[model samples]
Target: MITYNPKDWFTFIFRFHKADTLRQLAPLIIGISVYCWIVAFLELNVFRLSENSHVKNITAMHTLLSFVISMLLVFRTNTAYDRWWEGRKLWGSLVNNSRNLAIKLNAILGHEEAAHRSFFKKIIPMYASVLSHHLHAETTRLALDEHEHPELKNLDTNRHMPNQVASMMFQRVNRLYEEGKIKGDQLIVLNSELQSFTDIMGACERIKNTPIPFSYSVFLKKFIFFYVMTLPFSFVISLGYIAIPVVAFIFYVLASLELIAEEIEDPFGGDENDLPMIKMASNIKKHVAEILN
Candidate 1:
């Protein structure tokens, strides 16, 4: 995500970040301006409609519909933000669980068990890295170590990567339990964190797979389009040429909100506003290595 100082209002206003909706909206803004100008001209010069004309009543309709549209946009934005925040929370849980698992394994395993230490250290973080790739629909190759462990090499990239990784961790932990490496109580303690890896993965998958309802999304776009297109009809009578900029600004505000909602709703993607999955995965790797090593 694009990080910035929230306190720096002037910088935010003056600088157009790469993901700024203004860039995407610029061409549409110009088109709307030109369209508004034509509408204003036709209404004023050609139709010669007066303020008392029935056409001017459209402004009242807009005033009432503005409340409705604002409510819809508020719901839309909030819903999208909730998904983004939930994704972040799930990843946060993954980070905490990974750390807990590594810490537990460190305490339970003998200091001489370098192989087990190496496996847990690499595999815990590998879960996060693999989940990140899984959500983005990329190959789970980046997380693979140069000297990959023999057990991890059996992972079928064609299958669900996060599940395979989780299964591997569980199998290894179970083996440790069977071998009397970890006691019954220690197994129970480790179970929660190990299971949480899959839980977190499932939650992330829900967010990545399900999207905002298609009809609702389509209706919102159409609502904005029709609402903005009709603005000149409402304002042109009294405002004349000035209505062009007024309508354009309104469209800009409404359209920008939709654009932001769209970008953030899928927090796993490459959008600048998306959750920092790669960085989080790297942090998990670093922290797990620190704990296990």
Candidate 2:
């Protein structure tokens, strides 16, 4: 994610980055401006649509549609941010649950079960790393010390990596139980943390797989496109050459909102507006290791 100090108001307002919507919207803004200029010149010099009563009706239509678009954009952005926040919360749960599992393992098994305790602690961060990569559909070949986790090198890449890692965790819990390393009462507590692992994984999967409905998104795009394209005709009739910048600014506002909503809708991606999954997962690893160490 792009990080910068908001030194002054001007810098913050004009700050440009790869994730900024202006890069994508610039071409469209220019097209809209040129179209507005043409319409203004034609209506004033040749066709004289500016004085027509129809222009007033069109402007009135735009005024109403602008309100509707504003409301729709609000809902879109809110929904996107909700998904983003949900992903962050799920990661937070992963961190907390992992820490809880580690603490309990250390308390229950302690130095006597050092080898087994180390297994779960090491794999905990592996799950987080693979889960982050899984959401982004990237390959995860995270290096692991073979002595710590023998199965780490053998885990099947064909299967869901997070689920596989969780399965290994559950298997270790069962082995400990079979050997009478932990009592049933302690087993119940550890199993609960194990379940939490699955729960967090499921929650992140839901947010990653599900997206804004196609119909709603498409309709909004089409509506906004028509609205922005026709906007300059009426605007130019009223404001002449000045309407170019005015309509361009309007296009920028409307398009920027849609672009931002799109960017944030998928919070798992590596975009600036997306959740910092890499850093978050690393932090989880570091903290869990510190606890176990």
Candidate 1 structure quality by residue, lDDT tens digits, 179-277: 988889989998888888888888899999999999999999999999999999979988989999999999999999999999999999999999999
Cand. 1 TM to true fold: 0.97
Looking at candidate 2, the ten consecutive residues that score lowest on lDDT are: 48-57
Candidate 2 residue-wise lDDT, 1-293, digit = tens? 66677667788787787877889998998888888888888877787774564775688898888899989999999999899888888888888887888888878876776787677667888888888999999988877788666667778888888888889889989899999889999989989999998898888889888899999999999988899888777877678789899989988888898888888888899888788888888988888888787
Residue 286 Cα positional deviation in candidate 2, in Å, after optimal superposition = 1.0
Predicted structure with the largest lDDT when compared to the true one: 1
Misplaced by over 4 Å in model 2 are 2-8, 50-53
